[model samples]
Target: MSQDLYELSATELSASYAAGLDPREVAESVLARIADREPVLNAFYVHEPEQVRRDAEASAKRWASGTQLSAFDGVPATVKENIPRSGIPVPSGTALANPPVSAENAPVTDRLLEAGLVLLGSTTMPDWGMLSSGVSSRHGITRNALDPSLTTGGSSAGAGAAAAAGYGPLHVGTDIGGSIRLPGTWAGLVTLKPSAGLVPLHAPYMGRAAGPLTRTAADAAALMSVIARPDIRDYSTRPYPSMDWFKGPANPAGLRVGLQLDAGSGAEVDPQIAAAVQRAADLFAAAGAHIVELRPFMSQAQLAGIDAFWRTRSWADYSALEPEQRENVLPYIARWCAGGKDYDGVATMVHYNRFAQVQQETIAATRDYDLVLSPVAPMAAFPAEQPMPVDDPDLPMAHISFTMPYNMSGQPAATVNCGFMLDGRTIGLQLAGPVGADDKVLAAAVWFESVRGDAALDWARVL
Candidate 1:
């Protein structure tokens, strides 16, 4: 292959290993790439090249003896800093909490290690995983690899940068709201937020799931095949059968695909992103699928209510901290949590109830369609120094309206690059499906990847 080992996809690396390529060599290539890019991107909180080399040596031995643990045995990969790996401290993107080293691996980490992936290190995230931008108090800002001045959307900030910079073939990120997809959008990658509980997590929340960020949808599916397993640890884990996640392109012909151009709340969609989504819809229609225009299913009241609930949840955590520790938090995050401090019982209950309402509305609106297409975010990547798209703590969530509803609804959602902005930033097209439709959503993503020909990106020259 013309590309270097570090540039290979996970599937490609697997094949090369099967053909007798040594994992150690691949490991060195990735280490060099990381060293070259890390200074500007600041993508990882932990990156130990010696440890990576040792793991790669072991994988090389396994391959040499015809006893490779898995097809992905030695492929480079990263986990978000928030996901605990036994013996590693999870800072949750804040400097305030001095977390003890974890005694056990997060379920996602267990699966990644078990599959024999070379653990590159933990990636950076924003304070408390609250902001959509990459600014963090603990690890500093993670810039977009494609364009350093721009934000690598978070809280999957570093994971996005790592994947885009070819630091690895697989990166695990958790999505509660739009964390995974938003970064995937701005960073130009394939990312998934599985149906809630489909990928069991360590400390599961309402809409959080562990998923992959890779350059290709197929690579995302390859990573999903390992991580989306049942773990007794997550009470919310769904009872799902083992799936053939790499099944070929889904037949789009005769499928009913919904086009959602309006989020109905928050920031208005940028013209470039809106047009890109429409182009995606046109491609689906051209491929023989029925494209239906969808009415906005979410309202500003619903968005505000959910925002209020989140603020309180975060404030509760902040209020419990010592004053100095609380002061250590990012100022933007502090301001955002301040709104949660004074909610009365009635107001709190009303805000909490919005989740059920949002969920119900999302499911009801999409029940008639096999898939729905929309923009992953309202606009392209923002300034890296900013805390959020709007740069206002009071309006921190203005850009998440398009991607947050699916998290509440527990639907499977994905972001795939469909186009690019004139300034060269990526425009992500989001594809969502009804709850329990992980396979369908992923398959559709793969199909789209095949049809969305030649994105014309060159990461080699990006830096």
Candidate 2:
């Protein structure tokens, strides 16, 4: 089980020790690789070098005694900046969102560490982690690994780029509305948005959940077992499953699959993306699942509007900033939510009710299908420095139009790369499941992986 620096999966690296590779050597090799790439990628926001060295040093001892913590033992991983890292501010991707660095590890980070993965550092993010384009005025924008000219999807931009650029195999990324999936799609990696409440969210804004962004869907399953523990800090999280995401126990045969061919965005989907989705559908049919193309029941406006409650993000994020630094925040976000503006207490409740109604209707409509499939991001990546090409003349880009609905409904969802667009950018297919169906979603993603395998595009080949 000897492995090269970059090719082994997170699970494989842990398994290598069982087959004879020294876990400490693998850990050291990962550190060297991170040092080699950090300058070019700029992926981390707050890295803990001495702490990580100590953790790896301890893991090295465990390796010699043949008493590793588990399969992911000694594996290197990074957390998004907003997730509390015990000493870093929850800088939610915006300059205004950073308060003092935290003094204790957040529940999610504490659980993951207890599972044996060393936290290398915090990955960079968009301010408040809300901006869809992945640009951070405070920390320079994260560029797509495939094409520096293209924007990395956010607000999990750094996690996405870090994986594609060879920083690590497993990392955690939150997704309210495509934050995890879009970045993974744009950067050509696999990501999971577990059902709300499966992964605990102790942050005030995240309410009650979180998820993983990884190189493969199988990695997501491994991460779920690590981070899905109940947290008294966030009472809403469910009890950790005795065993989660172990595949082959359930059969995929005759599963009814629904493909939302058009996601009500009204934007003209690039033909290449549509073709890639169709190919995925054909493959599913050949594998014995029944695939049906259906017009989805939800609309973009209805889904986007759900942010009123979930994304009080702007206000929840920026209001905590110092008065003077507030002006330096991202202009659009600051202007929209600053000065004690935006919503009154009453309006906020009404908005929440309206959003809930939409969720009820969407869930009722989608219940018949075991898995619902759609394109991850309607459009492909754009330049890193510019705003998305919204005024493309032929089509206007409404970022998050396709992803926000699941956030509203609080469903478990994920992205799987299927093919490359004509422009050479990657296209991903999203697979979603009912709320509380976290294991089911990961199982389907793994089944999708067993069939399509990994994506074919290489960074050097495209950008």
| Best by the TM-score measure | 1
* Worst window of 10 by summed lDDT in candidate 2: 388-397
- In Å, residue 321's CA in model 2 sits off its true spot by 5.1
Per-residue lDDT of candidate 1, residues 87-109 (tens digit) = 99988888866676899999999
Cα lDDT computed for each candidate against the true fold: 0.90, 0.72
Q: Which 10 consecutive residues of model 1 have the lowest summed lDDT?
A: 454-463
- Sum up the clashes in candidate 2: 6
Q: Provide the clashing-pair count of each candidate structure.
A: 0, 6
Pull out the clashing pairs in model 2: 92-128, 93-126, 93-127, 94-127, 94-128, 151-382
lDDT of 2 by residue, 219-247 (tens): 77878878877777876666544545766
Candidate 2 similarity to native, TM-score: 0.90
User: Candidate 1 — which pairs collide?
Assistant: none
Error of 1 at 25 (Å): 0.4
